[model samples]
Target chain A: MSALLAVDGISKSFRGLKAASAVSFELDAGAILGLIGPNGAGKTTVFNMIAGVFPPDEGRVRMDGRDITGKRPDQICRAGIGRTFQIVKPFGGLTVRENVIVGALASCKTVADAEREADRVLDLLGLADKARQPAHALTLPDRKCLEVARALATRPKLLLLDEVMAGLRPTETDRMVAIFRQLNRESGLTILLIEHVMRAVMALAQRIVVLNTGEVIATGTPEEIAADQKVRDCYLGEEAA
Target chain B: MAMGRATRMLIGLMVALLLAPFIGNDYLVSVLILCLFNAYLAQAWNIMMGFAGQLSLGHALYVGLGAYAGGALFFHYGTPPWIGMIVGAAIAALVGGVIGFLGFRFGVKGVYFALLTIAFAEFTRILFDHFTWVGGSSGLYLPVVRADHDNLLLLRGRPAMFYYVILGLSAAVFLICHRILGSRLGYYWRAIREDQDAAQALGIDTFKAKMAAVMLSAALTAVGGVFYAFYTNTLYAESAFAMHRSIELILGAIIGGMGTLFGPILGAFLLTLLGELLTRLAENFGHGFEGVKQIGYGLILLVIIALRREGVWPRLAKRLGLDGEKAS
Candidate 1:
């Protein structure tokens, strides 16, 4: 099958420094692709480019064979991509359900329909009990779940999750990994995640791509990535040693 | 239960407002009218700043634009004030659109965006102060008709008529704001207000949403200005477009509660009542106490800000079992 999302030789540069250069990757439908890299590896930059935060300096981004490069974030989202921020951005004053309703409204015909959809998403994310609470009152793990719930409410074909497990506890991380597995298997939702938690990434992602300094160093199954010499020497080696 | 309380509170308020004119006191009626007028303007300002989180410290720009447009038409072409009001609102909306486009498109926001609004208002004030056609710094005066003969068509001088008109305007504006707060645009505005970058990531067109808010706010404020021109029977650039006017308009919104629907109205009534009382007290204390009213206002604002940063309305609403959501 054709790739659900294709990033072709994308490059982005800031004033005097290159944030990302010639970064390319493909995500197939129903696949969980883990993007692992050291700090400042330009992982977020690649996500931003694909999500239409800014136009890539060179190359193109295509979703399901249609070019979506340089489109506005809202347009890109409407065209079937939803994303979460590394730093959570819940509508602090709105209720947890209302925050999700905002995303659901993009597809729903009425507020009631949106609310219903939001409820389902919140329940699926195990946030139903906190549905009526203000988003600012949520715990870190709940906040992360809220972000995922909001993204899922948009009913996107592909979801880009940015560091959703960064501040989570081990149990919380495991729960999140299980959720991702269920989403991939049951809903067939394509996911591209940037994560620092190696164990969660290894457990959830069938395929892993390691990036170092804005370049891809390795791409293979999780087990293959564990044994790759360059990945070990550059990224995993520091953690292992 | 919360919805029932909110509904009851709204009904009670409407009944009180509707019966206010029958109290047979002209001074009281006039004061109430002015209170409602302030409420209307603050509500207009609230839509842009309160809902959309776009701080405009120069909201008087729209009001002044509206007054000049409407007042000038009436004074020159003999156009009716109703048509003038619509035309004035349209002009203000156009100006608002331009200002919003320039500000949002160029990425000006927060304090800088506020400064831009102030600069525009100040620039217009200076231009109007010099322009001779609309009477310049001396000011423009609507033809004073007999106060006893109530002319509803021309909105000629009559306290009762002005009171009822403003009451209607306030009600209409209240309904519009309530509708917006319950709609998709309201959700988008709240999202953008919380975090623009995150809102964009969620597929919200932050720029367009904010621009719509600016235009809507400006248009409504212009309508208030038209009423002010006809009701007060005079307009001057200094008083109409002054930075103090803008500050006065927003004080009600801030003091009542920034984002809540009823906050601005409550704040306006409370502040205006206190201001009137303070002014009367100063008069009783003789000449040197003229500034006491202003001092009182300043002190009240300071206390409100320090004591209850969320303002009086939200707490009051909660106490009355009417607060449905946390104030933004």
Candidate 2:
């Protein structure tokens, strides 16, 4: 079966620094993929390129067999790619529901329809209780969850999450893992996530891709990636040391 | 469901405004007309700054464009003011759209965007100052027809007529703004206001939404300009396109609680009333001071800003149990 998303040798450079270089991966339909890396390994830059914040300096991005390279972020969003920021970008003055509704409005026909979608997404993300609160009032974890809820509201074919579990406690991380697991299992939602939390990554991702110094260092199942000698030398060994 | 206190209060205020000309002398009625004019202009300005978060400090450009368009048409072609209003609106919208295109297309934002607007306004003012077909820097004058009968069609005659016209206009603008603030477009605008990158990531066309706001605001302000041209029977580039005039247009929206439905109207009334009251008090005290009213106005504005950063309308609404779940 063909992959749902194909990131073929994407590279990006800023000024004299290379952020990502010829990094490539494939996410199959209904599968969860983890993108793990050391700090400045360009995980978020890859997300930015795929989500169309800026075009990759080289290489193609295809979703559902359609070329989507170099499109505007809004166009990419409507083409069914939803993404979360490493730093949460909640519409602070809006209510939680309204923040999600903004995302839902991309696919929904009307505000009423968007509102219904927002309610559903908020309920799914366990933010239903705080739906009426201004987003600025939310705690950091809830704000991160709100970002996930908003992306989900777009009804994406591929969800790209960036560091949502960074500051979360282990229990909270487990809860997030469970939520993502449910989303993947029940709806067959495809996900590509960047995470520093190894527990959540191991618990959620079906396949793992490891990045180091702007290149894909390893790709395998969680066990294979953990056992890979090159990955250990470049990333896991540093973490252990 | 029962009607909210805010709605009831709004209805009462509307009724009072409708009856004001009948209860007052010409001077008082004219003052009320001035208040409503400010209210209308502020409401127009609010769409760009308050709703879309695009701060335009050159709103007088639209007003001046509208006034000149309408006044020039009437003076040279003998066109009725009603037709002139439409043409004026179109002209203002075109100019506003250009300004918006330049700013948004080039990604000029925040304070830079504000400077761009001011630059355009100042440029236009100078251009109009040199353009002699419209009477150059001297000014453009509309003939004061000595018609015994009041001509509503021509937008001329009595202070009371001007009062009702401005009052009807202010109310119409309020309803228009309220409607926009409740729609999907309004939600999109608010999202863009809160965060542009986030809004874009959510698939909102921030540039288009902001452009719509700028053009609509300019069109509405132009209509007010047509009204001003006919009501005052004159238009001067210096007075109409002045930097201070642009500043005056935004003051009400800023002080009344920007982004709130009733904020601009409330702020406009408060400002106009305070200014009038202070001027009257100075006259009564036999001081006849040139800048006392301005000093008092500035002091009050500082107090308002210092005390309520969010503006007076939100707190006032909360006190009256009129706060709704929606931001509006």
Candidate 3:
């Protein structure tokens, strides 16, 4: 399979502490790649660099054939990269519909087109029913759905989700997993999921990469990683199978 | 029910404002004119603060800069006030661009952002005071009587003329802000305001969007300042660029309703009337203290913020039956 995105020798050092040390990976097109890590393991930091929150202290991030490292976030977004924050930050004063419109308009030159696109994305996510409700009024799970809806509105070629299932119950996770799978099945989306819930990850990820202390400890199929020593070592002996 | 209620209130206000000029006395007309001007400035400020969430404290910087740029050309270069007005707005926009670039690039946040604006206003006041070419601290003055009382030239010297001009300008600003608040830029602004770090990660260039808002707001504010200078026929250094003027302008917006369309006008009218009435009341009661009204104004602000911080207009609009305007 052809890799759609490549992160080569990406390193980030904060003062004397190394947040990510020579991290490297590839995400193939039309595949679900699970990124697993313990807390403070540079999982989201790596996501931030790829999404252009900050330029890497070293190395390059490439999409298709273009070098996108150190570019402005908006430029990166327009070039078809979209991300969701670990902490959902919706426009608190705006309605749910308005929040999604922000993402839809990020690439649009005109207002009317953004609104139309935002409405379609909301309808697809089943958020059309609560479109007029203020974002502050939403419950946690729906707010997570809002984050996903907001990112999808941007129409990214690759979506980077950071712990979207962290606080969700099993039933909610199942519903969301179904929706995500449907999106991939119907639209050929490539998803990079950073989730702590192994059940969801094992069920969805075609391949899983386990990160420990900013370094990749293991990379293989879910079945292979479930049986691997390194994956077991990082998981503290809670084997998936 | 919502749209229908909004429509009726709009009709009622139209009839009230239309009748005031012809039937009302000069004092009331003057009050209305001032209210309208405050509404316009509040609208301009809202584009920056309410939408972009920049929290500027010295917006008088725009007002003062705009006043001088437009007034000076008319006073010296024999430029028509109409063209000079545009020039004033342009200069304000230029200054706004500089300020926005510096602040956004350097990552100014919250109270520090406010301090940066105040610093600029104070710096400008000092410069203008030293630069006697524009009349300095003695203040900029226009040619009195302007060759005749009935001069229909844009800069004609008459209260009635000034009133009409300010009214027209305020209406134009209202229409422009009305358009912007519904535009794509508007959504980006609120997004940035809500969370700048989050906005950037979602692929928003907070810098560009914020700079654009500031530039637009500055240009419009300068136009207002030009009228203020011409109408008053003077531009005192302290009064024109005072930090207090900026605070009062913000107060108008906040008290009226920070982000609502008509909040500023309501704020300006209420505050101006309060000041006028307090003066009349002091004189009538024979209890004369020059700064008492100022004290009262401060207390009122404190009380309003302590009580209804979101603003009086949001509440007023709800009571008057105007709900949030849904994007159509």
Candidate 4:
């Protein structure tokens, strides 16, 4: 079977500086793959290209063997890919349910159907009680969960998470990991996540891709990645050595 | 059936308005008609600014275009006013579509978008000023057909008849606004209003949604323009497309509680009544200044901004225990 998502030799440059250089990766259906890298490693740039924020300067992005490079963001989303921003964006003036409803409207035909999907997503994210509160009133962690809930309401086949565990406490991070695990195992949801939090990445990811300075430095199972000399020399630090 | 407080209150308000002309003096009826006319205009403007988060400071362009288009057809061609209204609305929608396509497609937004609208309105006014076919700068005057004064079909009518027409129009527009706000497009608009980039990321076609708002608003405003032309029996490019006219169209929505269902209507009534009261008070005190109404409006706007930045309707609704199902 064809891969669920294939990023083939994508490159992006802002002015003279290259943000991503020939980055390539493939994620199979129902797989949980983590993307790890140092700051300025062009992780988010890859996410942007995949989510159709902007087209890459060169190369193709494929979903289920269909070329989706250079499509509009909304079209890409309708093609079954959902994404979250690094900086959480909750529709501040709207209530929590309302924010999710906007995302749900993308997949559902009617407003009533969207509302039902929003409530279901909110319930899964444990935000049912705070559904009536304005999204601006949510705490930082709750806001992060709200972003996830919004994305989930789109009913995407592939979910792209950008630093969703940042600034979260250990327990909060664990809760998120458990939720992702349940989603992956029960629903076979494919996920590609960029995470700076190594503990969460190591706990959640079945395989890891390490990037450095816009290039893929290494890709392997967590144990294999931990044991790689080059990964230790560059990213995992001397402790991994 | 268990009716909500707001539903009951709205029914009461509509019934009172329908009975107003029967009990009130002609002078009072005229003022109410004026208030309802503004209410309709404000509601049309609200769809663009409030729901879609697109500020149009030169909405008078649509009003002027609609007034001229419909009025000219009726006067020269002897066409019925209702048909003229549709023709005018179509012309306004086309103009609005052009502006929307240019602005949104080229990435003009926020205050820049406002300026684009202003420029277009000013440009149109200048063009109309020299277009002698429509009477040019002197103004276009509709015929005073005394025999048709009470004929609703031709839109030549007495003050009482006009009052009922405007009342019906305002209520119909309000219901349309309410329905749109509850639909899928309404959700898209609210999302766009909060954050454009985020809304785009969430799979919303922001450009299409915004364009819909601009055209719909323009078309509705033009319908109001048709009403204005027939009711006043006169249309001047200077007054119809003036910057002050555009600002007047939006003030009611802003003061009423932008982005809410009832805010624009409440704001129109409050502003019109207060302006009239100020005029009377100034005359009674023998201190009637040339800009007394303007000064009163300025003061009222300041007080409202300082105390209730969200606008008057939300607060009033809350006080009346009607905030349970808040409309946005």
Ranking by lDDT: 4, 1, 2, 3
Q: Give candidate 4's whole-model lDDT.
A: 0.92
- Pairs in clash, predicted candidate 1: none
What's model 1's interface RMSD, roughly to a tenth of an angstrom? Answer: 1.0
TM-score of chain B of each: 0.97, 0.96, 0.93, 0.97
TM-score of chain A of each: 0.97, 0.96, 0.95, 0.98
lDDT tens string, model 2, B234-278? 778888899988988788888898988778888988988988988
Using TM-score as the yardstick, the better of models 2 and 3 is 2
TM-scores for every predicted model? 0.97, 0.97, 0.96, 0.98
By DockQ: ranked, best first: 2, 4, 1, 3
lDDT tens digits by residue: candidate 2, A1-241: 8999999999999997999999989999999999998889998889899999999999999999999999999989988989999888899988998899998988899889999999999888899999989999999999999999998999998899999999998888989999989889999999999988888888889899998989999999988888888988877875532
Worst 10 residues of 3 chain B by lDDT: B319-328
Angstrom error of the Cα, residue B37, model 2: value is 0.7
Q: Model 4, range B202-303, lDDT digits (tens) per residue?
A: 899999999999999999999999999998989999998989889887888899999998999999999999988988888887864767888888898999
Error of 1 at B191 (Å): 0.7
Candidate 4 residue lDDT tens string, A96-203: 999999999999999999999999999998999999999999999999999999998999999999999999999999999999999999999999999999899899
Alpha-carbon runs more than 4 Å astray in model 4: B1-3, B147-149, B285-288, B326-328
